[model samples]
Target chain A: MTIEFDAPSRDKLALEEGTSFTPKFDANGLITAVVTDADDNALLMVAHMNAEALMLTLDTGIAHYFSRSRGKIWKKGETSGNLQTVVDVLTDCDQDALLIKVRVAGHDATCHTGRRSCFYRSVRITDGVPRLISIDEHRHFVPSEVYKA
Target chain B: MTIEFDAPSRDKLALEEGTSFTPKFDANGLITAVVTDADDNALLMVAHMNAEALMLTLDTGIAHYFSRSRGKIWKKGETSGNLQTVVDVLTDCDQDALLIKVRVAGHDATCHTGRRSCFYRSVRITDGVPRLISIDEHRHFVPSEVYKA
Candidate 1:
C-alpha cells in the first residue's frame, strides 16, 4: 500500500531531534542510503536519498533517488528492470539517514554501468604512484540498441 | 608520491578550520564517506571508510572500504576490477565525515552487479501496493561467485 509522508509523526520528530534511532543526513539535505543483505548484513550498495526520494521510497517500498546528473527523480530499474524489493527501512541514531534492506529481484546485478555494485574498481599504490587494479573481462548489460539516441 | 597522514600542520589546521572541515567516524571508527563527481561537489555515494582503507585509498588512489561482513579491508576491484581512483579527500564541517572524489577508471561500470550504479532499482506503487519496478536485460558485471561458496 502507499505510505504517506508523516512529517509530524513521533518517528519523524525523533529523527529530527537526532535521537538514537535517527539516520544522519549531510548538509546538502541528502541522507546516506545504504542497502544491506538482511540475512548477513552484507552491504549491497551505498547511495544518496533526498526527502522526496525518501518519501517515495516509504510510499512505494521501492527505492527512489534524486539523480544529480539528470537533476530529477530516478526510479531504480526503470531502464534495466533489476529491482530492489524493500524489506525494511532503518535509520541510524541521528535520524537524518537510512539503511534500506532489500531483496534484489531477478539477478543480483544492481549497477547500471554493468557491475554488481557501483564500487567495482580498486586503488593500489606502487612505488609512490597510484594506479587502478585491472580486471580480466568487461561485460555490458543494456545493448547499445536499447538506448540508441 | 607517498602522502603521509601526519598530524595537521599549523597551516593545514588553519586551512582546515578555515574551511570548517571535520571528519566523522562511525561506531566502528570508520569515517563517514561521501562520494562525489570529479568536481568534488556533486555527491555520488555515501559510504564508510575505516582508517586502514582510507590509508590504502590515499596511498593507491583506489577506493578501499571495510566490508562489515568479510571483516577486512575490501578493495573495490578485487573481484570485478571496475575501480574508483581517488582524485581528492575532503572533510565536512563537523570534522566527523569525509568527501572522497574519484575518477572511475576503465569502464563506466561502477556497480558490482553490472549496472552503471548500485542504485538501479526503483520503488513504485502498483495497484495501491508498493511494488518493485523491474527492468528487462542484465549486462556488464558478474555475480560474486565466491559469496555463494
Candidate 2:
C-alpha cells in the first residue's frame, strides 16, 4: 500500500510548525517542484508532481514528475539516462511547493538538452526588447544521440 | 506602456534556441516562477506570474508575482518591506518556467514566517510516514511584529 498523507490542518500555526507532511495540491492536484543540484546547489529544473509521483519519490528516493503535456507520471531521465537520486526534499511555508535536491546519475545532467540545468540562458533587455542569451555552454551528453526514437 | 511579449514559436527548436522571450503560460495565463537568492543561490520561494506581473518584473527590475489565492497582482514584500530586486531572470529550455535571481531588501527575508527562504523544512520518513522537520531555524525577523495587522 502507498503511504498516505494527512489532510492539511486548518490551523495556520499547526500547518506551518507541525511535522505532518500534508501538501496542498492545486486545483489540478499538482504541486510545483524546484529541482537543484545537491553538490553545488545549482538550480536545475522545475517540474510538477501529482500525488502518485510525489508518493513514488518519497517511497523510492527516485525523482519522478508529472508531465503536464503528456498527462502522466514521468520517470525523469528515463530516456536520457540522467536519473536523479533524491538527496533531500523540502517544502515551503504553506506546503504548496517543493524543493528537491538530487544527485543526478549517468550523464549527471538534468536537462533534456544535455545541459546540467534547464536554465542555461539568461534574459537581457537590449534597446527595450527582452532577449534570451545562452550563458551555460557545457553539455554532459549529446541529446540527439541519447534520445533515439 | 508595458512591454509586450512575442508570441510563442511553433517550432520546437526555435522555441528552445531562439532569442525571443515568449513565455508559455498555462491555461490560466500564468507561469511558474522559481526564486533564489543572488548571493548564495538559496531557494527562496516558488510563485506564479501572469503576463502583467512578468512585464512589471522585467520592466521595473523588481520581483512581482500573481497570487493564486488572492487572484491579483502581488508586489512581493510590499507589506513586509522585503522587496526583491531582480538581478537575473532565466527561462528554462521550453520557456514555460522561470528562475529569478534577486537581492532582497529590508528584512532580507522571503517567507511571511520571517524566514530567509520559504523552504526552511526538510521532509524525512519516520517509521514509514513522511514528516517535516525544521531544518533552517534562522529567523531574520519576527513575523508577528513585522506583519502586524
Candidate 3:
C-alpha cells in the first residue's frame, strides 16, 4: 500500500505539533533527505525523495531516493554495495525536509566516488584565488571496479 | 567582484583532483548547504545558496541564504541575534553541495522555533500509524520574545 500525506492544517495539533506527518513536497513532488551515519554524526549524502520513496524508506528501513536523472526510484547502494539501513528518521518543523540516520553496510561508503562521504574536499581561497583541496583523501573502493563490474 | 565557478572538467585536473573550484548549481541556480555546529558535529540547518548568497557567506564567514519565500538573499540571524560564524566550508566531490561548519552566536539557535537544530522531531510508526514524537524538546529561546521585537 502507498502512503499519502495530508496538507498541514490550522488545527493546533496540526500546526504547533501534529500527530500526523504532513510533508510539503515541492513543485517536483520531492523533498530533501539529509542522510548521516548513525554511529557518528558524519553526513553521508543528500538526496531527494518522492512520497513513494519516503514511504518505502520508512517501511523497508532502507534508504531509497528519487533519481532525477534516471527519473526512477533509486535504492541507495544497490549498485555500490554500500546499502544504508535506516536507524532513525527525523523531520524538521515545517515538514519540508527529512534527516535520516543510518548504518551503512558493506564498504560503509555513501559516495559514488567511493569516498566515505560525498563531501571530501574543502574550498580554499589562498592568494585571492579560489581552489579545492582534498581533505579526507580516503577511498573505500575504486569506483571503476564497483560501477563497471 | 562576484565569483563564478567553472563547469567541472573531465580533465585529470577536475576528475582525478583539481585545484579549481567548479560548483554545479541546479536549474534553480542554487546549491544545497548543509550546516553543522563547529563546536560539535550537531547538524544545525540545511539551507540553499545562490551565487550571491554563497559568495557572501564565503566572504563574510557568516551564514547567508537565498530565501525562497521572500525572494531575497538572507543573512541568517539578521533579524534574530543568532548569527553563524563559519569555521570551515567543505565541498562534495561533485562540488554541488557544501558542508558548512559554523560557530553559532547569540543563543546558538539555528531554528526559528528556538531549537539549536531545526530537526527536533522523530517520526515513528506505532499501532501501524505514523506519528511524530518530539526528540529534542529543548527550546533555547521563546520565539515570541525573539521575533516580536
What C-alpha lDDT values do all the predictions have? 0.55, 0.92, 0.84
Q: Which stretches in model 2 have alpha-carbon errors above 4 Å? A: none
Q: Write the per-residue lDDT of candidate 3 for residues B90-137, one digit (tens) a residue.
A: 887667788999998898899988988988888887655667888887
Sort all candidates by lDDT, best to worst. 2, 3, 1
DockQ of each: 0.05, 0.77, 0.65
lDDT of 2 at A83: 92
Best-fitting candidate, scored by TM-score: 2
Model 3: per-residue Cα lDDT at residue B110: 92
lDDT of 2 by residue, A1-149 (tens): 37778878999888888899999888899999999998888999999999899999999999999998899999998898889999999999899999999999999889888898999889988777889999988989998899998
- Across residues B30-145, which tens digit of lDDT does each residue of candidate 1 receive? 76675655642333345667767887788767889886657888887666666788886644322345556677665545554455444333344445443333231254645554
| Cα lDDT of model 2 by residue, B1-149, tens digit | 45888889999999888889899999999999999998889999999999999999999999999998899999999988999999999999999999999999998999998888999999998777889999988889998898887
Q: What TM-score does chain A reach in every model?
A: 0.72, 0.96, 0.92
Candidate 1 residue runs with Cα over 4 Å from true position:
A1-24, A39-42, A134-140, A143-146, B4-149
What is the TM-score (0 to 1) of candidate 3?
Answer: 0.93
* Candidate 3 stretches greater than 4 Å from native: A10-16, B8-16
The DockQ-derived docking category for candidate 1 is: incorrect
My TM-score estimates for the predictions, one after another, are 0.47, 0.97, 0.93
